[model samples]
Target: MPSCQPLNRMKKVLTAQAEAEKIRRIGEAEAGSIEAIGKAEAEKMRLKAEAYQHYGEAAKTALVLEALPKIAGKVAAPLAQTSEIVILSRDGSRVTGEVNRLLAELPVSVNALTGVDLMKIPFLQKMTNPQA
Candidate 1:
């Protein structure tokens, strides 16, 4: 009986140690799974934030593109109107000088003239030929 008691005690200790090892392994696995899930969630958030920032920049570019034509039209209308004025000087050089002076007095920058051909006008011949 005394030898049987020692064997029984040894069996109980071995069983308890095995159970404790199993519990430890299960706890470690659960902790690892939780950490992996947290990492995945953090990555997902980072990607979403980057996408939103890019979307905002794209929207701003679209807005600027949409407004460009209207802004250009507003700036060009006055210059177009000023080019229609006819200068009635006897000398062609004087008429050209008067046109330049009028253009310089305008509020906006006028680099080029458009909408009319000076050669097509009947009065330009008399202006160019002062003796006639």
Candidate 2:
């Protein structure tokens, strides 16, 4: 019975060691998952930059065109809730002018905010005038 006591104590110690190793492995897996997520995000950004460099201004212009509809929808979203919009001016030109003004200002506002004038960019300049 005394010899059995030592054997039982040794089994308990081994079991405890195994549990500690399992917990450490789980923690390492969770840490690895977090690191993998960060790496994936960085990879996505790198691909986007590579695409921009490869496609140049044409790609930028295409992206702008694709975004225009979404941007227009957002810009006009406020009017969606309006029950009625009363134009004080008798002339119909006021409504046309307002719509035109909003459309015209969209590009200007985007340029001002982003500080990226596509026209002035070297890629765009080269694209517009091949001789340059």
Candidate 3:
């Protein structure tokens, strides 16, 4: 009976050791699963950030495209309304003299004026005359 008691005690100790080992393995597996979940969440966040950046850029480009025509019209509106005056001259020398005189009398810079302004000059009648 004494020998049987030691054998039974040894069996109980071995059982406890086996149970502890199982519990430790279960804990390790749970930790590994948590780590994997964290990595997946981080990847998802990174992808979301990238998508938002691309969307912002596309929106900005769309806004510029929509506004370009309006911007161009505003820039050209001042030049479109100007009218040309024509002066008829028989001689080339007389035309040149009148043009020089008109240029000297103008308030604004000639170089800054558009081709629309050049067509408006009265002394330079050839520019405005469609028949010539």
Stretches of candidate 3 off by over 4 Å are 57-132
Q: What TM value does model 3 have? A: 0.41
TM values, all candidates: 0.41, 0.56, 0.41
Per-model root-mean-square deviation over C-alphas: 21.9, 7.0, 22.6
What pairs collide in candidate 3? 84-120, 85-122
Tens-place lDDT per residue, model 3, 50-106, is 875777544644554456468668977996887865767788899889878876544
Deviating ranges (above 4 Å) for candidate 2: 1-27, 113-132
Q: Best by lDDT, which number?
A: 2
Off by over 4 Å in 1: 57-132
Estimate the overall C-alpha local distance difference test score of candidate 1: 0.66
The stretch of ten residues in a row with the least summed lDDT in candidate 3 is: 107-116
- Write the residue-wise lDDT of candidate 2 on 1-132 in tens digits: 357888899999999999999999999999999999999999999999887888866567667767767987998899999999767888889889998897656657767755446566567568656877
